[model samples]
Target: MVLLTLMAAVTIGIVRARNLFAVVVLSGIYSFLMASVMIVLDAVDVAMTEASVGAGMSMVLMLGVLYLTKVEEAVPSHTPWLPLFVAVGTAAVLLYGTVGLPPFGAAENIVHAHVAPRYLEQSIAETTVPNVVTSVLASYRGFDTLGETVVIFTAGFAVLLLLRGRRRSRPSDDA
Candidate 1:
């Protein structure tokens, strides 16, 4: 509960901050807070991922982006109320859409009866992994996880290449 509050506060801070550097730092802090929440929920694999990629690598990447750009955010030229209304409308629609979903953690959910039981029962026998998440993500969902990882790495690489190219293409003022 306290971690969730802190995350909300950090989010507000990020939104209110005009400095891009501060927003990036606060976003990293938010990721760490989310990782803590994941740990508290006993999702250690998710926590590790949030800490490593979300808090660690993402901050480093954003910081690198900061290095290549201005630290302060420019003032908006247009009024934000229209965009705010659109965002609120989207959120309301999404929330309404979720009303038909089963209550969270309900064992009666159809999907829970399927692979979850298998993961809980035979995962250890099949993968020798004591951790169900580890077995599920690394074994059962291995290809999916691998593909997602590849996509993330590829996106990061693309961002780096674009930033580097932009830098090199700029005319040197010192000349």
Candidate 2:
């Protein structure tokens, strides 16, 4: 409930902030809070990815864009009812789905009995890491990590290319 409230506030701030920097910072905060919620949900891998991509890389990219362009711009408001309707409808569906979920940490669920146990049992032997999550990410699912690294590198390269210089000011013709 608290997480949902924080998410809503951060989203509102991101939408309403006049300064680009403030919007970016608010988005980063939103990402961080989302990551925390993911942690609470026992989705550490997703949380890690979200933290790195959202709070870390995206914030840097936003800052770079802000440096290249002025931080403030005149914002025009438009009819927001369409988005409001969509958001409310989506939230309703999500709430409905949440009611069907197994209670947290229920041992009888298929997740604990089947999927998670295999990792807990085999990962130590397979990867020699006491932490199953680390072992899975670094060893078992290495290819996916490599792909994510490549994507991050590509994003950084693209940002660099896009922001590569023309002088911010033009010299006077008299000079």
In candidate 2, clashing pairs total 0
Off by over 4 Å in 1: 156-175
lDDT of 1 by residue, 130-154 (tens): 9898888888999999998999899
Give the per-residue lDDT of model 2 (tens digit) for 56-102.
98898778768766999685688879998999999999999999889
The residue ranges of model 2 lying beyond 4 angstroms of the native Cα positions read 1-4, 38-53, 160-175
Candidate 1, position 135, lDDT = 84
**RMSD of candidates 1 onward, in order:** 3.8, 5.1
Clash pairs, candidate 2, are: none
